[model samples]
Target: MKLYTIDTGFFKLDGGAMFGVVPKSIWQRTNPADERNLCTWATRLLLIEDGKRLTLVDTGLGDKQDDKFFGHYFRHGDATLDNSLAQHGFHRDDITDVILTHLHFDHCGGAVIREGERLLPAFKNARFWSNEKHWNWALHPNPREKASFLKENILPIEESGQLAFLKEGDLFSPNVAMRYAYGHTESMMLPQISYKGKTILYMADLLPSVGHIPLPYVMSYDVRPLTTMEERQSYWQEIVDKEYILFLEHDPVHACCTLKQTDKGIRVAETFALENI
Candidate 1:
């Protein structure tokens, strides 16, 4: 099996909201904010190549939204979904599967593209994978999360007849398993992959960056902050005990990291590119 880091570029989010209850004084140390108090975050994705099946873990925000809509997020950077795929000698049409961690815009917006007046699946050849629980949650989004779950980003896969659901105990690939975390969003799926004699856990919104390693650094966007804390507490310990390499999606500087049981708590032990693994 082969793996590649797919960087779809960076966008800004309010640092205060990203850090939740954590003071800006602390989070700013790792993810420094701009004049607007918005922190730059990478919409980094993962590509799993196992034989003929080319699976893309998540698609970053696509270029379909209007300028007024995009003005809010301030999406910047040279990396793009198409350009990133081409760098790996692949294309969107080559993807056989697309594992959507959840239907949040930043995570799944690129799953569909706007052609003229029609919104359609971006990866026409791929089967978009999402869990049933999260699918329902995104469809009937709560007021707080409605903005993040854009109907244009979703619904198209189902409409295209390419949507698939991963059930509990189901293996996405020969070496990948689906794990669920509910705090960030309902039934957010994290893909656990066994590669090169190491285990890599894709850290979706559950753990955005190294700065969020500390127990209390949960995100305000999370519907259930307390549940997020509990989930992180458990996942961190296991990650440390088993020495799992975490594939960070939103961390701008670090693509992957390992956790160590330090005197302070489970903290980032090391950070490096996925290719180094």
Candidate 2:
């Protein structure tokens, strides 16, 4: 099995919202914000090459939104989904699976693209994987999360007849298993991948960045912050015990890190790029 870090680029989000109740004095020390209090975050995706199957996990915000819509997020960076795939000697057509952690715009927007007046699946041959729970949540989004779950970014996969749901405890591949969490969104699937004699947990929004390792640093975007706290505590304990490498999706600086039990709680022990492993 081979893994590639597909960087779709960076966008900005309000630091205060990203950090939830954490004070700027605290979070700013790690994710320093710009003049507008927006911190740059990477919309990092993952590509898994295992013989016949090529799976792309989580497409970043695609370049389909209007300028007015994009101006709000301050999207900036050179990395693009197409170019990133090409760098790995692959193309969109080469992908066999699109495993979405959740259907938030930044996470799944690139799964579909606008061609003329029609919105369609970006990866023509890929089966888009999302859990049934998350699929329902995104389709009929609540008012708070409606903005993040754009219909244009979603619905297309189902319309294209390429959407598939992983049953609870289903194995996507031999080296990969799905773990579900609900703190960030309903039934967000975290891929636990065994590779190179190491376990890499794709830390979707469950742990957006290494800075969120301190337990209390939950995001305001989470539907249930308290649930997130509990989930993080349990997950971190296991991560520390087994020495799992966390593959971050939104961390602009760090790609991956392993946690160690600190006096306070679980904290990052060491950080490195995925390729270095």
Candidate 3:
């Protein structure tokens, strides 16, 4: 099995919201904030190539949203979904499967694109994977998360008949297994891939970055912050015990990191690019 790092670009999000109750003074040391108190984050994605099945984990914030809509997130950077795929000697259409970790715009926005007046699936030939429980949760979103779950980015997949629901125990591919984390959002699928004699767990929003390695650094965007803390506590220990490499999705500086049980607690032991593995 082969893996590729798919970098769509970077986006700015309010640092306070990103770090929840964690003080700016502490978080800023690692994720420094701008004058607007927004921190830069990468919409990094993972691409899996296992034989004929070419799967993309998550699509970054798409280009289809209007300027006014995008003004909030401040998406920037040169790496685009198409360009990144091209760099890997592949195309968007060549993708056979798109596993949406969740339906949040930053994670699934690029899954659909606007063509003329019609909104359609970006990868016309690929089957879009999302869990049934999360799909329903996104469809009927709460007041708190309504803004993040845009209909345009989501409804198109079901409309295109390319939407497929993954059950609890189903494997995305021979080397990829699906794990659910309800803390971030209901049934947010984390793809656990066994590659090169190492286990790489795709740390969706469950663990955004090395800065978030400390248990209290939960995101306010999470509907259930306490649940997030609990989930992180459990996952972090297992990750450290097994020497798992965490594939970070929103970390601006680090693509992957390993955790160590330090004197304080579990903290990032090392950070490196995916190619290093």
| Candidate 1 lDDT score relative to the true structure | 0.94
Task: Give the C-alpha miss distance for residue 143 in model 3, angstroms.
Answer: 0.3
lDDT of 2 by residue, 86-135 (tens): 99999999999999999999999899999999999999999999988899
lDDT of 1 by residue, 1-277 (tens): 9999999889999999999988988889999999999999999999999999999999999999999999999999999989999998998999999999999999999998999999999998999999899999999999999999999998888999999999989998889999999899999999999999999999999999888999999999999999999999999999999999999999999999999998899899999999999
**Once model 3 is optimally superposed onto the true structure by TM-score, how far is the C-alpha of residue 82 displaced, in angstroms?**
0.9
Clashes of 2: 0
Q: Kindly report which residue stretches of model 1 are placed more than 4 angstroms away from their true locations once superposed.
A: none
Q: List the residue pairs that clash in candidate 3.
A: none
lDDT of 3 at 213: 88
Instruction: Estimate the Cα RMSD of every predicted model relative to the unseen true structure.
Output: 0.6, 0.7, 0.6
lDDT of 3: 0.94
TM-score for predicted model 2 compared with the true structure: 0.99
Q: How far does residue 27 in candidate 3 sit from its true spot (Å)?
A: 0.5
How close is every model to the real structure, measured as TM-score?
0.99, 0.99, 0.99
**Global fold similarity of model 1 (TM-score):** 0.99
